[model samples]
Target: MQHVPFPRSVRQKASLAFILVMLLAVGNVSIVQFLLREGDGVAATLNVAGKMRMLSQRMGLSALALHQYPGLPDLAPDQLPTLFDEAHDALRLGGRAFGLDIPAVPKALSPQLLDVRQAWMRQQLAVDALARAPAGDRVAVEALLRANTDLLARTETMMDSLVVQAREVQRRALYGAYALFALDLLLLGLVGWVVSRRILQPVQALARQCRALAVGDYAARSDLPPGDELGELGRALNDSAGRIERLLRDIEQEHAALADAQSMFNGLSDNTVAGIYMVDESLRFIHVNTRMADMLGYPQAVLADGFPLHQVFTGADYETVQAQAMERLSGRATRTRYECVARRGDGEPIELEIFGSLMSLHGRPALIGIMFDITERKRAEASARRAALVYAHTSEGMVVTDADGVIQDVNPAFTAVTGYSADDVVGQTMNVLSSGRHDEDFYRVMWARLQDTGRWSGDIHNRRKSGEEYVERLSINTSYNADGSVNCRIGLFSDVTEKRRREASIWHQAHHDHLTQLPNRQMFEENLRLSIEQARLGGTSFAVIFLDLDLFKDVNDTLGHEAGDQLLRLVGRRLTECVRSSDLVARLGGDEFTLLVRDIEDPDDIFPVADKILDSLSQPFALGQQTVQISASMGAAFHPRDGGSDSELLRAADLAMYAAKEQGRNHFRVYAAEMRESVQVRQGEFARGPDPASAPAQSG
Candidate 1:
């Protein structure tokens, strides 16, 4: 049989299609180039016209300034030269707009450009005359200003005309471009119709034939005419149908084998413990194993209903899965392994570790992911993490050591307390921090407790890396292994140096006067009692001296309390100096003070110390900017002679002090038996009437 020849091969038809597309692209480029050229010309003309108008206005203003003030200070020295240069540039640009020295301008703006040039020339001439005018020449200045104003007005009108022309040119260009576009679209539509008729129609017919053969219809034929590659394809399809018919029987046998293999694969997937799933391009699950269905708390039938991948995750988790999916699709990642909270069918959340990769499933792009339920594992991890965080962040310093007490590890608090880093102390013995304050017995006792009870706690003095000693409340525990042997030891401690110092400060503040730091009344009484006991035991006498500042209240009223406090501090220092180191000097409230003169030979021995105290206190004291003169009155009582107890001695000394005050201030008086009677009689006399002799002798 004779076969008809095809008119065109596939290569020829493809070449013709490419040529047509190239022609269309060339036409588009030509049109774009024409529009761009026209636009550039219009833009240049508009720019030149605008500059000319601005320069014209500037020259007019400059002319006015010269007319108003011709002084060199008022007008810039280069103002006239700059104006001339600007006028020249405007003229040049105006000429260039009409193709004088640059690209040709659009014809529409030619008349406007000519008018601008004339106005600019007139404006420049007027400005030149103004700049050259004499300072007092009012008539010339006025004439030049009028000319410049008229020229500027004309230049502005020309600029407006130029703008209108530019807009017209642009409108025309737009219309031309639109016309060209329409023509191009019409031609493209015609070409497309021809291509569809000659190429697509025949191709579609051949495709139907192939489709028919694919579905096991061997008799279908395209019946295409022999003129092009489509005709050749039609004949090829006929041949393919014959071959397909012959292969159908073999394919059926192979289909049986494939079905069996698929069944086996399904069986294996169902028996697997891990959940396996495949998602289509639309993120819908097209296949899921029995393990996956059960893992999601869903039946196999429900999973086969095309569940979406996004629905497997909760709201917050779905967003993360979507971001990972996008990253994989964009080729930034090939596989993703992440943990997310997945929702079961009953809306309960389960932690899942998803291991996914981009793959092709059933001829479509998809994700094949394996899901592992990690709810229990995650719970365990979270608990461990919380315990670790507490151990690391606790304020108590922690140290881990071997059974022999060699340092192994340290927490951040250890660094803060000991000023030693893990790198500095690791492998070093714990004794490295010992301040040498603890004896061998102390350590022996501590180790004995640790061995017997597996724990020890005490206040220990340890030196820091700076060689500074600090107290730490330390507790140590030994960890044991299965065989009851020591594994490691953990020590917990806190730096209590500041706490101890604060406690000491509080004790001092309580027992000592805040202003003068001398022993307060309570401490003085305690010391006096102890001294009385010692005096009685040793058969030695001690004196309890009471002293009062004369006119101290007057000093406080004259100056401020601050000055009065300074005076009291000075008096306290003098009193301290007057007493021996073994003696006790105390502030007994306000300006009164007392001293326990220990180991005195007799009551008279207290007289010299009293005199020294009075003399020291009588001296002038410099308080800031003022010199203050003050005195003290002293009274003494012997421990055994005056009284036996602290209260009795204090009372005797107080009475003697009042007697000394009555006789004269700045005087010392011993506790005489008659002094007590004298105080009582004086009190009775003062209650009655003033003594006639005691009354300040009438000044005359």
Candidate 2:
């Protein structure tokens, strides 16, 4: 047979082209998004900063104009509007020459800049008042003008600072954009080279490995050959080659080993045992032994029928066996303990058990099957009753009970599980095993489910003869005789008391806060809803108090969050201690916590509890080796008085919570319905009012 190897370079060329195009597109997207877009953003900011600088220059020009045309004493009182108007009109034109938004820029700063402009207005008003006076008193007007000029200089300095900051931001952004563009180009070059290697390198290595295997090299395997189909072929070749090597070595040594091992099977087969003339797998001699030929009644000429195994076993069964063996061969993947069947001369079938693995054989997928006959052993097993003894029975527990729940057959394990033995309660009813906690209803339901479904599975709590209760995972099954009538009832039982206990513990841990082990927000809300229902049913005063750790975020950001969490846990412990054992203390997430103290005497009782909570958190917490002090701000709202509903009461408490935080931290405050107005009033009071149109009219 002749063989031709496939070329790796030709196979990888199309993939290489696709990879190159993707790399180019990626490089272009990186350029447009990171480089050109950033450059555009920097240019936009530069324009804004440039505009601010131009405004600053215009302000300087206005100051220069005031110096050039000073308010003169020589100018007549009636002609003063003309002088002021001329200066203002000329300054407006000069402002437009630059890109200054003169009206808007000064307004954004502190009112001191507007105050300087107002001082100039006051100066003009004084001048008008002096002109109307009996002898034109110009002294007050001169003092006002001098004061206005000093304020204008201060305003100019503030404007200069703003211009400097804007320009600096613009300058940095420009430099960063260019630097980023340069780095982008360098990364794009590196990526292109990487893409080239990624496309070509693997295919070349696969080619080298394939060529290494083609020349009778059995010790070879391939990683992949770029396609799933070809890669699978490569694996099959590797597996087949390995099997062939082992087969050849075994063939060379089989005669010597057979001489040593054949005595174990002497006289096992006779001429009439299988009713077939002697024939080997390849239609050769019956045995690589002399006595086996004597038993099978065959001469050497009769053994060699000169027929291929495939031609002898034809039809569906023939195709099935060959297909299974060839599939294992082609996968270079390994296998062992494989089974297939072959047809006998009398039309009877013989089953074969073969064990082999994949190996490379001159770059071809192949196999070496070692066949054995198991027909006699299989026949004896199927003809008799089947009993499977399972040795690893840790996960499976067995029990044998008679019709009346009497212990008939029991293993030593049953005594260890239920804490009962054969002599202790053998004749007793199943009720003696009950913990007596669940009523007769539980037993009735269990019986009903088993009767309806033929099986029932559930956890059962049972008492031992010594009166100790143990929980068990109980599965009850009803067995039937030949006619499908009931034969016996079997219950598989395993003690799961420890497992149930652990599950309960885990559920409690998840719902409760870790450090305080108090009911968390989720549990608190649930229990609170239940509490509210109880309160409504029985007329009682109850209150929900909300507590917050004051400036906790600042402490966490400045110090570490560990200190913050420790502080929160400490607060939780203190809150629990302060309330009654019957009351609830819950830690909400972060620095917030809540106390549900029911059966209160009055709303006033909440104040003392809130005060205690505040005091408790105010005290230092022992965190690690360090004693760190943090405090709480408490806000409280009462049920029925503050809110009839749970959500309403919580909201009221939360609103008051922000109030406590606002009024310097570390204090308890009761909910005031009008507190919202107070905050709004303060915001309005802090804001500037409209300038009133007043008594004096000034020059333009």
Candidate 3:
């Protein structure tokens, strides 16, 4: 009754061909749209499912917190259920939720989704009951915990099932696309063959008859049947055999115009900066313009003769390039751009950037490619990378600042040395690190020198983030713009605080006594000289006292040198505590010490200092477990009355020391004129035998 529909005329067959093409296009589009929807829907559903699991856990934690601590506010008890319901609806049906376009649950995963929904309902009920329960409600907390655990388990199962179903759908879609493509290709080939036989053959016959008529054989005819468009065309051609000469003249002029257009196109292609070439579906070179031939160090004629692709692209990227060409021919992609390495004619490797597209050339599939040589650009990139590596790893702190000293960038080493991170210092001025140890004049002179010489380097004092002052050896270089104005300043520095500290330590060790940690004779003599100069200039007076421990040698002999050294250290500390901070204390040698008391207003001031020294020395000292009592003989001399110079004052003090020893073992004497005479008078007796009264003796 329907009268099977079949194409019986040329017009019907042509319409059939167009319908097949439209069907193939529509089928491909439908498959693509379905795949995209399936992918997006699976992702959105999985996201919502995962959130439900997390929400279950969150509710349990909040409930536990409320139970453990009384008077605690509920954490999202009211809003959480509402959110859960919305997400649940979005997942079960299809809608936009939580910023995601969710699709309805798949038929295959419907059972798992239903199970999750039921479990979540139970968990929701438990959460509501817990919210109303009192503090320390162990029963309510435990019930919610159990419900949430079950809900979480079901959610995980639903997600697993979702993933499995999504994979299956994608797999089926891929197979369907392959089968559909094969069917479309078969249909296209069959349509083409049918058209060639039913339409092209008739047209060719008409063309031949016309050609015969143009050459004066007017008896020719196409001999085609009537009724369809092709049959009508053949009949018309047979009737117009007499007019073939005029048609032939018009076709010749059209051919001439096409030749001129092609010549102009070739001329522009050869003159372009980029290399232009074309390749057939088999990847054999179909055309090579002059620029392309010159770029590859090959003759255009050689490439156009179908040079092998392997020889043209001799690099590890050959396979990738081949894959791109195949994708283009297979209708997977229409255009592509990529970088690859190629060999020049001299076998030297070069980098190239290529832009390619699929095109029809002479009614056959081909690829048109444009190439640019990027070897120099790649080399410059590598150099920049090496420089960046150095800047990051170098130990020296580096900072770049604008002409006005606003900080722009800093390296990691800068953070290490300054104790300031990039976030703390960037966009700030260099004064952030100022220690305020230098005056404005100091900076003014520094900038003056930099502006004159374009460089400045010195030891600078800077403060750390922790408010500690440190010294750094800093060097700053100035960069100028083309107009000779300052562009930027680059500073490189190293923290030299520890290095300078070590230097000071070495100086102290050289000038101080190692045994007692006091100023040694060298530093003591220097201080005395300095004091003498100050006293003379100010018309003031100072006292010098030379002291000797009476029983020091005996302690050394009885308790060994170690014990004597311990006693000396204790004596030094006590002597320091007894004197003014302005006074100087020194250990001259074994059993001998000196003191310089400056700015004495009256001569009597020296006596109290001498007495305090004697009293401090007389106190009992603990050596190991043994206590020993010792006395000292001290002698004092005044500045102008005793001597005007360091050498004379020291001699007077020495003379008075012996006089104190001659007077008694534990006494201090001011230097009188007779002390020096008394020392001379007893010189022969001190040489003959030691004076028992002044001699060293052990004190119990």
Candidate 4:
């Protein structure tokens, strides 16, 4: 038979079509979601810009009121400046602040926003100058008035330009979305066409051929060209029909041979391997060949003429044998083959395969049978069935390879685990399953150990037919021949990928924070200890910075715990970004985070990192529908200067952090001896009693 190469299997083609349709559908969904998010951000930014226009004029009016009514605290206009600054930041830098959710300004509107910023700065200076001047200073009032006008004009221009740019972006995004939708539709139609032509048509053709074969059309052949699994099924159907036709023809030839056997056996019965016997209608032995006579445990003369068949053939299958003999003599069947137990001359029961045919002797219908003792063959067959059952049903994957590591056979479990059928890996080297994670030396050592001990058991990394690497616990044993030469290698393995993944996940959860996925207090302390040891040995130093987010509790109280958690995660990311890759940042829980800067050559080197952390945290964090601005009160403790051990360094860092909070929030302090003394003095003061005049003010 000629081999016809298929472009792809039916399953692969169908899967490809399904995957293409799914990708298009997902792509459209993703594009829509992305555009909607961007649109939300843009709309929010425009709204904030519109509010800035109003805010510029409102601030000017409030300033004028404050100048006119300095005695009324309600008309102080202090909040106006703060509100104006918040709006300006929201419009220029963009985030959710004061409920004005937005993204940063677009690049096209950056110049306009810079002009507005400059104008706002001049107005801020005038406001400050007016506040410092005497209440009746007309020059101060006039300067403030001029700055407000310029600021208002610039805000309007920036807002107008932003609206134009936002419209253009929205229009382009809409066109792009429309084009993507159209392309998705076209691909879906193409997929449908492929399904019809490549899958449905071949399947229908195969179905028709199957129907023809079912109606006794043994000559039918499915003329499907090989391209997929459907084509392979068609070919298999054709082959089955041909096999049935051949079997029928073989039966006819067997019948012809049976007819000739009746006369041919008379001359050759004594020389044949199997015992031959003739029986009359009365079921008595009419003639027995020499082999048959020996099988009956009698001389040829005693077994001949009137010997009862039951004497040597007495077993549970006697009735079945009698019925089959009758069927043969009645011409119901030209030949009958059956297996039954028969007693040998030694009184031992043995399984026999008997072929019986109808024959004529002295014009009377008789039965002639050729019998063979199949006792050993039956035992071998039963053993083979048991072995095959174990091979097919066992859960562990089993592979048999030649001494040279060429794969010869694989059990069903092997295919289930490795995604490779026996036909796929047979005749291939075991290296086909190599994951390449192990170097050549690894395999060389494995083989060396196996050669020395004739067995190797360990975990091995291998790849599946799908190109996914997995680990398996494998045990391989060498099978040897009688001469002690290696015959084959048998390997049993079970997939351990999931087990390994679960172990890894557990370890990660133990050492990392669940909310931020950052190193937790435990891991951070371990690293700190390690850093201290390394620094002490090398005569180098490292610094530990402890930070507490200011107003973090206020955020939680105002925005809910979920928002607080989001803020913490964002802060973790920003903190990570602030430090070098060699530096370690960890959350010490709640609002506390710690950083370890390694190989600090100077204590002053820690100040820059402290500043960066403060600055990064000062940026606004967008949490769901709200945005929050927060800062960190940080403290730094050097290795030797802040005491040597982990506990000492941590205590120093804690004292300095408290000092930063006492000095005022949103500040950092390096660990100093005076900080501890100050803390102890404050503790003593707290123990005595609260003194309103001298007590340090606390900020949250």
Judged by TM-score, which candidate is best? 3
> Tens-digit lDDT track for model 2 on 411-463?
45567776677576566656667887788898889888866776889998988
Off by over 4 Å in 3: 1-393, 401-406, 429-471, 475-490, 532-541, 638-641, 672-674, 680-700
Name the 10 consecutive residues with the lowest summed lDDT in model 3.
Answer: 681-690
Q: How accurate is candidate 3 locally (lDDT)?
A: 0.83
TM-score of every prediction relative to native: 0.35, 0.33, 0.39, 0.38
| lDDT of candidates 1 onward, in order | 0.77, 0.59, 0.83, 0.83
Better of 1 and 3 by TM-score: 3
What RMSD, rounded to one decimal, does every model reach?
35.9, 49.3, 41.3, 53.9
lDDT of 1 by residue, 463-559 (tens): 9999999999999999999999999999999998898889989988888988889998878878887888787789999888888788787778787
Compared to the true structure, candidate 4 yields what TM-score? Answer: 0.38
Residue-level lDDT tens digits of model 4 in 531-562: 98898799999988888888887888788888
Q: Over 4 Å off in model 1, which ranges?
A: 1-393, 399-411, 426-463, 466-492, 498-505, 529-542, 580-582, 599-605, 638-645, 670-674, 680-700
Better of 1 and 4 by lDDT: 4
Better by TM-score, candidate 3 or 2: 3
Pick out the ten consecutive residues of candidate 2 with the lowest summed lDDT.
Answer: 681-690
* TM-score computed on alpha carbons, candidate 2: 0.33
lDDT of 2: 0.59
